[model samples]
Target: MTTRAWVLHPDIQTNRDRKDPQPALEEAMALAHALPGLEVVGGEVVRLPKAHPGQLFGSGKLEELRQRLTDQEIGLVLIDGPVSPVQQRNLEKAWKTKLLDRTGLILEIFSDRARTREGVLQVEMAALSYQRTRLVRAWTHLERQRGGLGFVGGPGETQIEADRRAIDEQLTRLRRQLAKVVKTRELHRAARAKVPFPIIALVGYTNAGKSTLFNRLTGADVMAKDMLFATLDPTMRAVDLPSGRRVILSDTVGFISSLPTQLVAAFRATLEEVLAADLILHVRDISHDETEAQDADVRRILSDLGVDENTRVIEVWNKVDLLAEEEQLALIRQAERREDVVVVSALTGLGVEALLAEAEHTLDEVRMRKELILSFSSGKQRAWLYDQGVVEAEQQTDDGFVVTVNWTQGQARQFHEL
Candidate 1:
């Protein structure tokens, strides 16, 4: 059954926000839509000077909105901000509807979208942590009298405490399981290290055309959708660059503004791919009104993940096809002025070659040219160099073959280790 949902973005006047309220409301509605079986009947920005402790809205305003929700038959109300457990319970009781906050809604979407075992476990842990704080709301039945022997003076093992304990136990178990999964991932990363291919990770705001760009670059049909968080599990594919260098391209979960803290902690293992990336492509929907704010959000998340200061990041202004021709020309001109920015339409393959060239050039800028001498007896090393496609030129000398190669520090280290 499709549950009717009403989205409300509380515009806290005292709080300073870089984004406009209307866009925030729209994003909340889109998040509500991302979950299946939820039909958003109405959405609006609710102005508030301050939040009420018991209920988020003022008494009269709450009653007014409650009547409107009843009239509209909204079964669910999604608040696009934090709601204390007490406030949530009070609001739900007063409004006669289920209530979900921004964190809860995002967690629901993640629970529905997580495909991998690691992703599932992470979501489960995050949800449990969130649920743990809401045990007060879950103990509504505790108010009812319980028939029991009067052995203990006080109520024995309150429902809320029991529920919290259960959730804690489950969280512990999930952590153990997550540790195993993370260990396996570490092993996989170690194996990939032997291949010596630079990993390029794509990161940006949700629905920023990262998967589309991934598909365009690697010819991999990852799910590309207009909806937020269309991609959750980290996907990797080897892509041959314009320079004939093979690099691993990783498409990771899209970031969002005000991302749930639980999610950041839970998905740390998944985001380690970004930390290990040789280059990060911060994709942006150039046509979106909140693109600048979204860019800040992505950077904040990256910084939280402890991304290296020296890591190379290229700003990919994507979705240029949606822009006007004049706007597109202006953006292209702007990108031409900066070496780190590339404007491309991933859907139409427009300027994608340039993106690839830029990626290659950025990776190549760190390369160190070295002269290596290989005797005839060292045929294996020579074959390895040729296979790597790093051998720029080779000349046979009386003693051996002098090979000039251009390779990254990592590749050079790998060769010496071999």
Candidate 2:
């Protein structure tokens, strides 16, 4: 059964957040909808001079919201920001409804969407960490008496301490399991590194249409949806560029503003793909009202993930089909003035070819022209050059072949190794 929920974005007047409150509320509602069994019936931006540390609202406003929740029969209330454990318990008790803060709601969505074993384990670890923080006075049995003589004080572990210890032990086990999984992933990455194909990774805010673009470019049937966090596990496919050069394209989990710290730490392994990428496409929904903000958030997360400044990045202005014709034309013209930006519509296939052409050109810029002379005895190396399609021209000589090729430094190093 769907749980009826009300989403609220607290617009604290004294807060320094520059995001417009209405859009934040809408995003919160979208997050609620993203969860499989949540029915977000309503949402609103509640303005306050400041948040009360205990209940997060003034006494009168708290009572009013409590009455409203009761009258509307809302089973869950989602606050689109941080809520202390004490505040959460107090509000839940006063309103008689289950409460979920932004982090908790996002965790729930991730728990539902995670598919791969690694992703599932990461979500479990993050969820456990979040739950650990909420363990204060949350259960009725927290004070239950342990086995001991009535005349003497109880000697067994306190419930909260026991719960924390259990979580810690489980976390240790998960870390061990995660280490094995990460080792396997590292081996896979090493194998791919030997393939001599540059990796291009797609990154964007949630629902910005990265999967659609990935499917269109690679012809892979990855799930593409309008829902936030439609794809959680990292997916990769080999794509042949317009110039006949093949590259690996990776689609990663989308970023969101104020992403949970726990998730960021947990999903580091998955994001290593982006870190290793030869090029990154920062896709954006140009038609969205908060596109710039979303772009900033994505960039912030990328920096936090330790993506180097030297890594090549291209800005992909996506969802042009959602814009008016004139607006689309203007955007295209604007993009044309920039070297690192491409305007595209993944759904309509508009400018997709241009995108591919630009990607190929950008990648080619990193290659250096080199001439090599190989003897007939170097047949294996000669065949490898031909297989990679990097040899621009070859000429027969007295006892060898002179080969002219354009290749990246890594490819040159691999050739030397051969």
For candidate 2, report its TM-score.
0.87
Candidate 1 lDDT, tens digit per residue, 5-118? Answer: 999999988777635899999999999999999999999898989888889899988988989999999999999998999999999999989999999999999999999999
Of candidate 2, the 10-residue stretch with the lowest lDDT total is 138-147
Compared with the true structure, all predictions reach lDDT values of 0.91, 0.91
lDDT of 1 at 361: 91
What TM-score would candidate 1 get against the native?
A: 0.87
lDDT of 2 by residue, 1-418 (tens): 8889999899999999746998999899999999988777898889999999999999999998888888888999999999999999999999989999999999999999899999999999999999999998544463663555645755665677778999999999999999999999988986776677988999999999999999999999999999999999999999999988899999999999999999999999999999878789999999999999999999999999998776778999999999999999999999999998999999999989999998898887877899999999999899888776689999999999999998765466557777
Model 2 CA deviation exceeding 4 Å by range: 137-156, 368-418
lDDT of 1 at 381: 83
